[model samples]
Target: MGLEVVPNTREVLIDLYTKTLKEIQVVPEDEGYKKAVESFTSHRPKLIEKKLGCGQVEELIEEAQDELTLIGKMIVIEEKKWLVDEDED
Candidate 1:
């Protein structure tokens, strides 16, 4: 029998992604933003796990990357808006 390569578990991936997300310093001041961030961070790993279980590893990774990109853009936009508002004060 040949050796098999096992992929990391969903929890492991979630932990890794969470660590990466922690590097961002944006503190969401709005309830909507807080909920959005919470949902995005929490739901993605579940989605990825589902997709991976269905033998859709490629699609799962691509979607996760895209979602992270969107989240990063959101954080940047929020940060910029906050900075501009502060400048006006």
Candidate 2:
């Protein structure tokens, strides 16, 4: 897995999610972002728990990458929805 961008200097995952939500126009609602966060939280540990009791940052990156894939798709859909709405006005 590749190294993911550092999620800001905050010590909490929720903080990271909150900050990320502010930076984007689409999927800013906690439900959407929270779903992504939940996806990462579940899958990340599954991969991590695979290794005795220790996991590497790379695993976290993998988990992040997976979550990003969903976010990107959702963002595209949201943007398209916004564009269509504007056209109808």
The best candidate by lDDT is 1
Query: C-alpha displacement of 84 in model 1, angstroms?
Result: 1.6
CA shift of 36, model 2, Å: 5.3
Per-residue alpha-carbon lDDT of candidate 2 for residues 21-73, written as tens digits (9 for 90 to 100): 44344565576576666554545445433552334454444444555566678
Per-residue accuracy of model 1 over 1-89 as CA lDDT, tens digit each:
43233376465557645843563335454656556656666666777745545445444444455656766787788788989999999
- Each candidate: what lDDT? 0.59, 0.53
Once model 1 is optimally superposed onto the true structure by TM-score, how far is the C-alpha of residue 44 displaced, in angstroms?
5.4
Residue 51 deviation, candidate 1, in Å? 7.7
Indicate the residue-level lDDT of 31 in model 1. 50
